[model samples]
Target: MPEIKKYLSIVALGENRDKLARDLVGAIARRGCEVNECRITPLGDHFSAAMLLAGNWSAMGKMESALPGLAEHLGLAIQFQHARPAEPQTDFRPYAAEVVAPQQPRLLGELLDFFTEQETNVVEVSSQAYDSGLTGAAMCTLHMALQVPVNHHPQTLRDAFMDVCDDLHADGLLDPIKT
Candidate 1:
């Protein structure tokens, strides 16, 4: 018999972030589905989550129906779709970094392009904008995980990243991911 593989990509938002995540994960696991990837973010007054699950078609069908009702009962918005298999991991060095700067348009776009040119793969990214209550200035903060291939020089990559941050007038720091 041929192997059967299925996946689910889900995104949800709700006011009760913690409760929603706990309940949703518990519900899926109870039904025998594997939660492969999950990222939850608290958006001040709201919460958002993205999750990937692996299960059989029948299991997915159950979730497809059950999730909507569950979310509605909790006053949340939910979206889901069947997902494709993930790409294989490559041999690379992982790094984590954070950037902070004055809020402005095009900052993220420029940073993304710089990473592309440097042959870096971004594993995860989270960004937020907020008012600096003391200074009354707008600020943007970005946190990211990146994979840099072994072929590249670590110092070189760090220098290039810092250069970009300098141009944006942002402050940044990069460090190796500890195993």
Candidate 2:
């Protein structure tokens, strides 16, 4: 199977930003799809959220149809598409990540910032929600044919995640994990 990635961006504006985001993620996940890069920004009276989704043909196709209804429910605009150019000819070293955020919108900002700082481009990003808090999982897969100096590894990704976690924690977005 060739590597195939897709991104789904949803612009949601409402009174409850966190609830809307969580519910949106839940809807995607319920379809058995994951959100890779999740982004939420405040645009005055409304909040704009863009989530990157990664999955195979069937999953992506399913999300495409279901997301619009989900967006309408949240009273927001929904945009989604599978990444073009398809997957490369190499097997990217993929590291799956799981992050929990209680602060909601801030989480999206934090996720974007970490990836930019880590020198890692988001190859395939997708997300899903679990419970009241948001549970997002992103796959960090590197393009080996690139000329970049940074060799791909798990630490590179872990470092990025930790940085975001720390920043989110400092800002009271992340809670101490329950044992």
Local accuracy of candidate 2 as per-residue lDDT tens digits, 51-81: 6776766777888788677767877777655
For candidate 2, list the clashing residue pairs, or say none. Answer: 34-127, 35-126, 35-127, 36-125, 36-126, 36-127
TM-score of each: 0.82, 0.42
lDDT of 2 at 107: 67
> How accurate locally, in lDDT, is each candidate?
0.86, 0.55
Quote model 1's TM-score. 0.82
Q: lDDT of candidate 2?
A: 0.55
Maximum-TM-score candidate? 1
Each candidate's root-mean-square deviation in Å? 2.7, 11.8
Candidate 2 stretches greater than 4 Å from native: 1-18, 84-179
Model 2 lDDT, residue 147, Cα? 15
